[model samples]
Target chain A: MYLAKIKVTYKPSVLDPQGEVIKSALHRLDYETVEQVIQGKYFEVRLSADSLAAANGLVESMTEALLINQNTETYNYTVEEVEA
Target chain B: MYLAKIKVTYKPSVLDPQGEVIKSALHRLDYETVEQVIQGKYFEVRLSADSLAAANGLVESMTEALLINQNTETYNYTVEEVEA
Candidate 1:
């Protein structure tokens, strides 16, 4: 088995409402030192592949087709082998 | 500065469309061993607080107000001190 860690984030230039809200919340909490707040996602996936090569190929296709919106978001992932 | 790593994910009972799509993609790529796929988000935030206590307070409020929708999702974060 292998563990795949996937991350998805909005394009930097795009405005993030969620981030803005967080920034405002920080300000209200007197954390004026925070200059910005950006929000994103993280996923840990368990794969049942027998080999690393096969697992990687699967994750690649998964990221390209579902985990990310190619036009607005970008994704990156890492795979680690787990001891059985 | 302190770094806050925030992770957001869907509630387990909820159906994750993105994850399902990714699962199909993996199948097409011949990774038939994958039984499930769950998608989520990751965020890295840099804070300019002078003390760790202040930074923690800020992140807490941020998570409650914007980083996560308490009703639909849950979030957790870690703060790390960085050298100047």
Candidate 2:
């Protein structure tokens, strides 16, 4: 099986309200050491593909079509093979 | 500066509705090869700490106190130095 490690996050230009909230929460907890907290979605996708190349293509398409929003968010991912 | 890569996900025992919805969407997109998807929270935490050990300690406490909910989710993180 292939596991696609997907991460989708807001564009740098976009304001991240959730991140701001978490950052404030951290400060409230007396963690003044925390400088910034940028939050995003993480996904571990398991799929069946013939080869590494095939898995990469599949994951890329999945990421483009459903996992990420093109206008507001950008994403990055890595694919690795694992024993099923 | 330090960059902490944090991931928090639902425990295995919990049902992931968002993941299921995405899986179904993938199937609709003819990605029948997709087996499963586990979704989680990802954070890119930028902070200042004295050293790697200090960064790790700081991130751990932050994760425990603010970033993750102990009862329903589990988390893991990696800390690395980055240019400010």
Candidate 3:
């Protein structure tokens, strides 16, 4: 088995309203030192594959096809082998 | 300056509807090898602090108080120094 840790976030140019809200809330809560906050989605995917290379390929394709909006969002992931 | 990468995830016993939905979608898309999907929130926080320890402390407190529900969710973070 392989466990893929993926993070999907808005592109730098995209506006992230949720992150903006959180930043303002933090500032109001006295965390004035907080300069910026970028909110994103995290996913842990466990799958069975023949090898590390196969696992990576599957994860990348799955993430691209189903997990993110290609225009406004981007993602990166790390895949690690794990015992089933 | 410091950059804190935080991940907030539900406790093992808690239900994750979004994850379940994604898992079903993946299976439908022919990713039958996928065994599980756990969804969570990710945050990139940039802040000004005196030291790495101070940054870590601030991030921990902020995350516990604002970013997660202690009753159902747990969080982990890594703080690293960054160019201002």
Best by lDDT: 3
Task: Pick the winner on DockQ between candidates 1 and 2.
Answer: 2
Location of the lowest summed lDDT over 10 successive residues in candidate 1 chain A? A59-68
| Model 3, span B1-84: residue lDDT tens | 999999999999999999999999999999999999999999999999999999999999999989999999988889999999
The TM-scores of all predictions, comma-separated, are 0.71, 0.97, 0.98
| Backbone Cα, N, C clashes tallied per candidate | 6, 0, 0
lDDT of each: 0.76, 0.92, 0.96
Top candidate, metric DockQ: 3
Off by over 4 Å in 1: B10-31, B52-61, B64-66, B69-74, B81-84
Candidate 2 per-residue C-alpha lDDT over B1-73 given as tens digits, one digit per residue, 9 for 90 to 100: 9999998999999899999999999999999999999989999899899899999999998898887888889
lDDT tens digits, residue span A1-84, model 1: 888888877887677888787678768866677776777767667787768998888778767765678878877789989864
Give model 1's docking category. medium
RMSD to the hidden true structure, all candidates:
3.4, 0.9, 0.6
Question: How big is the positional error of residue B67 in model 2, measured in Å on the Cα after superposition?
Answer: 1.4
Interface RMSD for candidate number 1? 2.2
Candidates arranged by lDDT, highest first: 3, 2, 1
Model 2 - which docking category? high
